[model samples]
Target: MRAIAYFKQNDIHFSSDLPEPRIGADDEVLIDVSWCGVCGTDLHEYLDGPIFMPKDGETNPLSGKQLPQPLGHEFSGVVAEVGPKVTKVKVGDHVVVEASLGCLDTHRWPKTRLSCTQDKPCGACRKGFTNCCEHNGFTGLGVVGGAFAEKVVAGERHCIKVSPDLPLDVAALVEPLSVSWHALRSAGFQKGMTACILGAGPIGLTTIAALKGAGAKKIVVSELAQIRRDFAQSIGAEVFDPTAHGTNAAEVLKKMSGDDDGFDFAFDCSGVKATFDMGLAFTTFHGVCVNVAIWGHKPVDYYPMLVTCKEKILTGSIGYTTLDFESVVNALQNGDIPLDDCKKLISGKYTLEDGWEKGFMQLMHHKDKCIKILLTPNNHGELKSAK
Candidate 1:
């Protein structure tokens, strides 16, 4: 087997002949990688170094996989093998693996359903709510192997089967799109809402597209780059050049919308403080502000006063849940996401042989211009391991 492994923080070496993963338990299944989408988090790991990867002697206690593992989460592939107890799916089934891997052994039973669903949810698993499962384990980075390499082994529960109509390359987007879905779900978005997204990158655009598909009356995207702004417009979002429009979204909105009032909902997808401030400034009174970007620091600021004054909702969104993932897949299957336009979202492509620094670094520095980049096996097979 071959794979792209993290030898150390900020270092990904390419190597072949890595041992192929075997079916660990009766509930597990192995998938042959088809297409893996490169995400912002992966680029963050490549640039900022590993913070979430498993360390030696620090096994998940659930799947028990160890340190320096392969790093891929958003991917789509075909089932190549199944464990003895795996009956839901078999060989040749095309599936998209969920990035999360919870402690299913404890939560699988109906009794645990109380802890898993709303009311007693502890903030995450509550019916319409649910971000990160506090009690559950992570799938790709923690408990199970990810889909970056030639093969990925995961519990059957994490695999979502796609209709044969959905191609593998397009299916690879299901996880990332699900992330946008979870963010919107967390924010309690409704139809006819006008949203101002403070970033036009891949995730930002995806969020805009999702809002449009859900019947948002209007979407205003704030982007600093012309390419990103153009991309947003290409996808049907009304774009605003925040940098050129004088640091004030109110003024920018007036210039963009003539005399329209503030937007109904605002989302900060840039993960930067400046964008956060702009999102707060442009949102309508009593509107919601959703933070979908991953900010490493304490996201606290004076925005609370603004939030309090307007009685606005301030919320943070995290990774996707099972239902969110299902919604993403269904959205794709129904053509609500538009595969043709979704394909255009892919601005760059790379092969694993180029190594992480080259491909991943490009993502870090040129994010304003690049949308999504897919990392394929050199031969379009398994990803080679680091040297």
Candidate 2:
């Protein structure tokens, strides 16, 4: 099998001899990948990592699987086979994988080194919050080999079938879109409510679409990059260049709100001190602010009065749950989310062999020029139109 995988820190490449993944349990599924999108986390791993990936010579605590594994958590594919107990979907079904692996999945790897016991799982998982599991990890990140190859296997619980009419390329986006959707859901977003997103990166752009689908009456995006602002506008966000506003930018953002007071919800996807403070500073008195970005280890300055005096809800959201995947799929199916807009997110496509240089490095160097770049196994015929 051919694959683009990560070995140790700063080492990821293509190989033709990577072993094919097999169904390890009776409820596992075998997927023939159609397309896989490289994520910022993938780039982070290549630059400075082993973050989610197990250390060299060490296996993942959840899967007990060693490194040098395939790297792709955002993917869509067709079901090629199903285990004896797999009842979610059968052969030939078009599907997207949920990709999350947590304490609840320890049953699939009885030999794993995690502390999950037969009767007790993580505290978060016990309360139905697998996304916040104590030992949470993702399939492609290190839990197991993922969809960046000819075929990958997962448990039936992680597979969600999509409409045959949905394009496979857009389907691969469900994973990332679900991340934003979950954040919105956590914020208690409602139709006709307004939102202010503090960034225009991949997650920020998807947050725009998620807000629109939830029936937002007005959405504003603040970004410093011209190209990213353009991308946000292409999908219906009212763009703002904070760099132009100087220190008075936060005041200007509040004036643009529907009430001219502040936004009903603000999401800090930029994860910087300035944006983080601005998110709280400009939100309406009782509005919510959700931190959705993967921030660094250093702590940022915070004023207790910013959130305390206003009685605003300050929270954060991580990975998506299975329900998020199902809801996003339904939204795309019912046209609440335009498939054409999803297609616009795709900036390029390449076969798996060339993915590292063309797809990964393209994101590494020329990130502003791209939104999402897809890679394929060439098993499907999308390569004929590859750019």
Q: Give the TM-score of candidate 1.
A: 0.86
Each model's number of backbone clashes? 12, 0
Top TM-score hit: 2
| Per-residue alpha-carbon lDDT of candidate 1 for residues 1-387, written as tens digits (9 for 90 to 100) | 667775566666666765677886688888988878777777666676565665545655544556556778888888999989998788999898777654334332333322333234545444333345565555445455565678888778778888877877778888878878888887888887788888887888889768866778888888888988998999888888776756565666744533255777878888787877777777777778898887777755664788898788888888887688788888888877788777777665566666365456667776665677777763454343211
Model 2's number of clashes is 0
lDDT of 2 by residue, 200-281 (tens): 9899999998887889989999999998999899999999999888899999999889686799999988999989999988
State how far residue 194 of model 1 sits from its true place (Å): 1.3
Q: For each candidate, what is the lDDT? A: 0.71, 0.90
lDDT of 1 at 296: 71
Model 2 alpha-carbon miss at residue 48, Å: 0.3
Number of clashing pairs, model 1? Answer: 12
Residue-level lDDT for 342 in candidate 2: 87
- In model 1, the runs with Cα more than 4 Å from the true position are 56-62, 105-130, 135-137, 254-259, 303-305, 355-358, 378-387
